[model samples]
Target chain A: MDAASAAIVAKPASVDGLLDLASRDMAGVDALIRDRMQSEVPVIPALAEHLIGGSAKRLRPLLTIAAARLAGAKDDACLRLAASVEFIHTATLLHDDVVDSSELRRGKVAAHLIWGAPASVLVGDFLFARSFELMVEAGSMQALEILARASRVIAEGEVMQLTRSHDLNLPQDLYLEIIGAKTAELFAAAAEAGAVSAGATPEQQKNLRRFGKNLGLAFQLVDDALDYSGEAGTLGKNAGDDFREGKATLPLLLAIARTGPSEKAFWDRAVARREQEEGDFEKARRLIAETGAETATLELAARYADDAKAALAAFSSSNSWRPAMEELADFAVQRKM
Target chain B: MDAASAAIVAKPASVDGLLDLASRDMAGVDALIRDRMQSEVPVIPALAEHLIGGSAKRLRPLLTIAAARLAGAKDDACLRLAASVEFIHTATLLHDDVVDSSELRRGKVAAHLIWGAPASVLVGDFLFARSFELMVEAGSMQALEILARASRVIAEGEVMQLTRSHDLNLPQDLYLEIIGAKTAELFAAAAEAGAVSAGATPEQQKNLRRFGKNLGLAFQLVDDALDYSGEAGTLGKNAGDDFREGKATLPLLLAIARTGPSEKAFWDRAVARREQEEGDFEKARRLIAETGAETATLELAARYADDAKAALAAFSSSNSWRPAMEELADFAVQRKM
Candidate 1:
């Protein structure tokens, strides 16, 4: 097998071993998600059927279900909470495509490209409203509070990221802060809601939430790294797309910080002007490699993965949730796409 | 004085009477609305300073406060609820300009034109999220549920309108339904929430809400009529802008329904196509007048105003809110801009 295929095969074996431990417990949650994702609006149902019924990793919902199971109170409430997280995640994706002006998502023409921007935006609003309605039905004030705050943070992070575009001076701390608000907060909320639904002890819920947050951070860092290194076809997008858009992701940010003034000028002209040609992309890759930015970024992602695994140590080692939680940590750093 | 000036002078005398009735009771509610509209974000503060701090009529908030007072409540909660309603209304305007690609509003460059679409959309989301946060702080689940559902319906109505663009055959029932969801529901919610917040009896709240709903219907129909008849400079927009956009407002819908075969082809080529030259505009206007569509629309709007006034019979004449409620019903039918 080719190196990429070999790597993919190795990772799933680890995931399989983890899933075997808790497969039965997750079945009902999965079914609930499939049911609630359906919509009554004709266009909505068609769009959703194509998008949600396709191959989604369902990572966020999995975290919620696992967290609930670990809390030791399996019930229908957990299923509803899990569905809420997935809906919010889906809603954000719909809006994000509009913000990014993306033409394709998940190998399909984006909804905005097909239906029009106004329709896509309103549909995204519909999903957001629907998600809130579902959360309210969950009937926990604390859950409502958590989800609302997370949604606001996500929006704020997006605005901050927009303002920071092409600014090579962005610090690693700022990068972490942005990702924490935009991505990790939702992940953390998903786990917390699951624990809350299942009546987990406060301390246990906090620990599980921390685990999800760290895992999410690591997941995003790895995603940014892969933008520079992954194959375009496999990623289902052009390689270096972030660089083309002048988004200063981890590898680019670190490289700018470490590189000399002369190399920095090249990046400033290319990315800040959003004028990267064929040769400029190669130079960016080489500069990132020469400055050890790629390696440093990967190391940071690995550290986060390790931290995530350690956070789960508060639970019993023999618990069924233990293995799935570990695979999540591993997946954070090792996934190809 | 000329006949029109005499009528204008006479109208303000009635307005003065309404203001005298509600002035003392409304001071605290007005002050609360002014305070909570402030924002900490630089863009938010700048935009709000220009938009909300301007001389807005504050009609919606006044209806909310007046409805609460009519229900015999004098609590701070009503003020906060009124502020929340206004915030949601303003947020929609910010986003709507971007959706419509409008260059001007209220005789100035629109917020999106001034700040860019991305900023407009994000700021709009911030305001929306902040409004929900405010409602949550109000600590009323019932209020949150009502406002949340209203928001969803408004968004759905927007999408429905987008889909129906330039369709001259749009049914009058569908047109009213769309406006009711998009415009009237919020008015009803504003009134209902005021009463709900102040612990009004259920029957009183229901009557006041119905009053607001009917009043809102009249208000929108008059606004649509003014699009064809109002002065361009005074209205802060071009006359016949709705006709140019092929919006099936009540008048246009009525005109299309009544058009004979001879003029139907003209509407199909000009109005339905939304491609109007100077001659086409004049011809279309003449045709609509000849069909008596304009008069029919005015009659329908007046009927709603009558229904709105009838709803106030439940409250005693001595109630402090009675005069302002009556003026609001009259204003709904008579406003020129």
Candidate 2:
């Protein structure tokens, strides 16, 4: 069997194992998130509650907490950093829903849809500001620098996505660059900041960041593949959202990379022109599956998952936290969303 | 003459003189703003250029730079703080234009109007992150805390304004509180951060912040009045915009405060229902003039200006920069916009 079949047959890692491993730290993070989300202005808390009170996992904050624990942190500064990292992630999601004109987020109505765009935008700013305040309270300049730089890179990636939205193919290198900045940068930073909070060695910090970056890439790839995988509950939002919005995702990009002028024209007319007829999404999904883009994307994701696990190999085998982190990477590839 | 009459006749201080006083430091800030605005993502810089390349006064940075010099700053850190202060101001302006659905900003078309709201918002986020990076680079925890808290307050104030937009009779205290957070907090933070960068005594920091807070109040009052004052160049955007948007301004609030059955009906129709006729702005302006509300507003602004000036009196009667700061406060009230 090929590597793709090997990946497809592989048993997924247990996410519950990692979560249980970091259960205490996760509880602290959740408490911090709840406390910091409150504001004197009633609407701030109202909007925050609406956005955060959902079934969606606080994965980014979990990573921060887990990374800190894995690196042997002593104090509660990682709790603050974990909360801050999640705030940034949540803030970005709020703004992104507005930008994408998304109708649903985390299996619920988008905050921007309920509140006006203006209020949503301001509340996102509030959360971003609060995140920085947490970093300041943490009193780590290194953590502050990493997260702040990640935020700038995230915004840059968003703009690049917007600008490149004009072109359909979007090029492989640019797609990687965009996803690296948009998704992986924050993941990398969250892990690095956690390591920094623990006062980890430079090499340890670099290893943790590498683990996170590869894990993030795998997570995004799996998510992108899931859009066309014809699986319900795999996407937080409606399936074919990427198709309807003409957003270039990995599966679609891989499908576009295949040879066929007719196939190219079909995508150009459907996605580039946004002139989708009835059954177009069905056709697009079928075409993607026919080309085995979903399988290919998932295979690539599994590769990254392996890379993430390898990055953590330098950590002592005796350190039980390292195994959980490796399992977390596998879970990133295996998760439906 | 009545007290209002005396205020109308008062000779305010020179703004150009204050700008001149801080010209050398202002150059450093301008250079920093230009350099920091650049991003690897082309659209980031492109959107920033459209927003920042205009008729912006950047008064916030001027106060920061001037206050630092007055407080005896020894290094170029104040220049970084000044630039960061201005970036925060610029970021809010970008988001404000989108929130207000503004057609113009800084005497040019709004960035949202040009780049679309999504791009405008993301770029605003980018600039805001860049501002935090600057604060972190300044390496003053005090400065970071001040600016971060101010940014959060600014967002809260914006949400408060949105919540209160339904009520024409938004109470005076709430109005003060809203504007204090939305406008004055940043000004206060700017001053405080400058003093922090300078490593000034706590007393000096308090005085500078007091000066900035009052000056911001005075500045906002004048701007609120200018919407009805019927001037062209005074406003960066179109005149009567506040009236059209039905946004609560000091002139409108003062006009509503006057007790008359017919007055209440008129405002209810114009602001609450937003059912103004073609000549309604003319009538609103005439009514404001007739009630001495604009004059009253200006008088109140002038009083804040006096308080702002008084805050600096303890610094030194002989500090060359002190008189310039006093002039800047006076200019905040006397300026057309």
Candidate 3:
């Protein structure tokens, strides 16, 4: 990490503030998640619980709760919307693991590996459908519209990534667009939907959505960087998984650009042909560090983090939720996981 | 086929009456489907069109339009809902083909085969989300609830079938439950939602739902029977697919029970172990035929068809749609496909 990034990290930025603030609402959301996921089909709940139970952060739903509370929510309808957001997130993760043939997720064996891809796929559908059911019960057409569009956009992003993410010459803007759609869009929708549930003004909804989008971008940028720099134990997924799969994530792409011709043969061998060998990941990581690619990625993430905090400036400083949310932006970039 | 079943088949029941009645509405539905299925992602539209363009009979949406018109709909809202129903059905077919790993759908190579399973799965999600967006456009939370619940039930049924469809000793009621959820719930919801769109009375909505449910049951029963007795060319799918997959559809189950000890070794090897030789499907077909299992299945289908027609008695005979829908019920069981 760069000196500035390292210094910020040394201070131990944390989501504890946001978590504490949203704890009670999140408890309700968790209960709703558990209650709705149950089915007489047995495997539906079993497979959903296998992944959802492993999820420690529940970050997206927390975003919903925090945004709602920040917008002065008076009722518990946001609780249902929060649970709906988590279901959408969980459904995407389930389908993503199946699509990627992923081995691990959230520090546990992937649900597809346990329940089989067919079950995982079907359960994902069930959760997606259930999310809509919850949204309907929440009785906000606006929130439902936001989430439905987000779900479609996320699927499009996944398809785009599947077909384009492996290209060596893929443009950086395209990659950003893919992540913005796939990852940041959900974050934006979660926050916006929560704000809508609380009857926030359009201006407030726009600002909260901006906050979430930037926060999500920062989160994904840091996650991509961590794939090259962090450990599997803390990451909850194998650190070198993206590298082994030859995914053209930001760090690797940046490193290839910075190193120029010096790493041409290495990139070709490791990424193009995917003829990876022992220590290849270590070599790639070393090159990323040596070329300052990891630092650059972290710097970009910090920029987004700053943008995320700035978006919350419209809220009153006296509201504790405001600072808690700003701290969440920093935590997005600073967390090792 | 039994004498009565053969006589019914000789009469050549057709969907032409319903097709003529809903021809204009169906054209609107077809156009809406084309418009909504398009995406900026190239492969999405291509893959969706590959399956959708090959669909000669858009039956579910037809039910929606027919039901709405029968219930005195004057607005075009039901057209959008009809398109939404088709999207839901197409999405399920895409996922179902992937889960079953079938090579044919609607007489064309399955979308998963052409675009790969990941694309198929994501596109299925895209269409599903798009279905909800369309429902939102239709401006009816009631319709959205019905479709959303139907979607969840369908996924649960898919998982249930994935886990239980292969059991040699599967019960008749359990088998009916699986198909009912997987295939018939959408039909019932489609009709009910259409009736809702027209502000139908509760009794009218109930009758339409019954019409749809019974018709869907007959359709699936005939489809199951066709897997054993019909020609692949006429069926638009491999005739022995269920047998090959060791799926205990009613025909195979009934044949196993009625054949008793005589075919014990055959069922044990062919179905229980899925150890089929070159002519095993042919042998299974002959056994199913000789034991009158196909006739019994068709007889049950006929009963459902009769019930479906009876449900429409509440509608005025002067209204052309009532007869068209009744004919549709017969078409469901009597069509070769």
Candidate 4:
């Protein structure tokens, strides 16, 4: 067995420990979220609740709470920042679903589908503004700056992906950059903001941010792999959605590279022109399995999970959050959904 | 003649003084907007420039600059705030165009029409985030708070209008509330943020906010009136847009009330059902003019303009910006477009 494989087997894959530890903090964040999402405009709250209430884990805000408590935060400032982080995440998801014409989110009908795209867009704006208001109340300009910059970077990443997602020739580094900006940047910011709110040392802030960034990469890589490996019932979102959308995720890209000349015509027809027939997704999945692309993708995810765990070296092992967060990193890669 | 009519005739309706007085400062604002709008992603800048570069008046940002200067601001902080105000306005316009499926904005094709709705939505998100980044750089939490609240209020107003705008029986008070939240709140926030940035006294801030609120009401009333009374060639946007969309603007509602039983069937078919034939817009305009609805709307706008001017009485008459701002109020009601 490879060192990476051995490490993956040795690590426990569970978020239950962190969830237990941060239960009170997460509840406070949840309360703040519900309170702030309300508006006199009936559609705003209805539409926001449709998506927000469906989220099971809310891992991004969990990162904030866990990072804050890990850094020995004593005040409730991190609670607001945590809620603000979730709001920012929710706002982006609303915009993203509209941009992608996504049909389902968090195992339910997407907000845009239920309320119409216009309402979804406007409600997203409302949540985004509400997030800044929460940040302002938190009274941490440093956290505000981090989240604001993350917001801009996320938008930029979305635009870049919009222009580049369909191109089969897109480089691996650029793809990493895209996901780094769109997904991992927010995770990094969320943890950093929490640390900043807690008045953590600069080194602690940087390390927590590093942990979040790597964990987010692992989470997204697993997400991409699960689009092929996961079943629709367990995945919340439909499996093969990326394939149907012709999104150039790493699993498909690696499969294409590994299959090489034999699949050239197939990829050109299926992906480049976005024409598909019955059983095409099945065939792609089969090809990916034959090429070991799914395994390769999971391996990459596990490496990132390992890096995420390593980032906790600065924190004392005596602290329970340290080991639980390492388990969270493993869970990010191992979870099926 | 009544005192109101005499006052209307006595006032000089021109923005030329304000434009000239703030030309140098506005130039700085213009430069800041241009520099900030640029992005590594090409489409963002391209789409942003489409709407922003076409705005000849930029009334909101102009209000911010005028308010700061009138409050005796000697620093460049107001310039960043002014630029931020414009970004907020521009972001809303981009999203608004998508929500309304608008074809034209600021005298050119709407950005969404050229780039597609997804691009427009994402780019608007970009600009909105960029607005906050600019606010953070300005280093005034008070200004940030004011703008953040304005943004949330604006989104709520839009959602309310989306649900209520098409109703033929929408009351005038409700209509005023809709427009006040949708339009006036930002104007009020812009001026107040400027005042706050300049370290103005609480009274100065309150008066400037009042000035902006009244000016915004005057501006919107004239706009609603112009839909029936102005020409497309002069208006930039097509004339009768409100009537075409069956929007229950003040003039339309007033005309509906004044014409009463005589024109009941025509309104029911044209506005209530939104089922119009070729000549419906022209006929609605004719009814509005014949009923003196357009004139009543303008009279109300003139009153608001007067209130806007009165709000500036606390500022010294010696400051050139004071008279310039008052002229801007007059011009809001007086302009043909």
Best by DockQ: 2
- How many pairs collide in each candidate, listed in order? 0, 0, 0, 0
Docking quality class, candidate 2: high
TM-score of each: 0.89, 0.97, 0.98, 0.97
As a whole number from 0 to 100, the lDDT of residue B152 in candidate 2 is: 93
lDDT of each: 0.74, 0.86, 0.91, 0.89
Higher-TM-score candidate among 1 and 3? 3
Compute DockQ for each candidate against the true complex. Answer: 0.48, 0.90, 0.88, 0.86
> Which residue segments of model 3 deviate by more than 4 Å?
A1-10, B1-10
* Candidates sorted on DockQ, descending: 2, 3, 4, 1
lDDT by residue for model 1 (B213-259), tens? 89888888877887777777777666677777777888877777787
Per-residue lDDT tens digits of candidate 4, residues B35-124? 989999999899888888855578899899999989988898999999999898888989998998877777887888899999999999
Q: lDDT for model 1, please.
A: 0.74
- Which of 2 and 4 is ahead in DockQ? 2
RMSD of each: 4.1, 1.7, 1.6, 1.8
Query: What tens digits encode model 2's per-residue C-alpha lDDT throughout B1-337?
Result: 6433454478645678888878888888889999999988888888888778667798899888888888999898999989999899999999998898988777888888888999999999999999999988888988999999999999999899888975887888898898899999998989888988888999999999999999999888888898899465657778888898898887888888874677788888988899999898998999888898998888998888899989898888688889888878877877776
**Candidate 2 residue pairs in clash (backbone atoms < 3 Å):** none
DockQ for candidate 2 = 0.90
Least well predicted 10-residue stretch by lDDT in candidate 1 chain B? B1-10
Model 2 chain B scores worst on lDDT over the 10 consecutive residues at: B3-12
List the per-model TM-score of the A chain. 0.91, 0.96, 0.97, 0.97
Best by lDDT: 3
Instruction: Order the candidate numbers by TM-score, best to worst.
Output: 3, 2, 4, 1
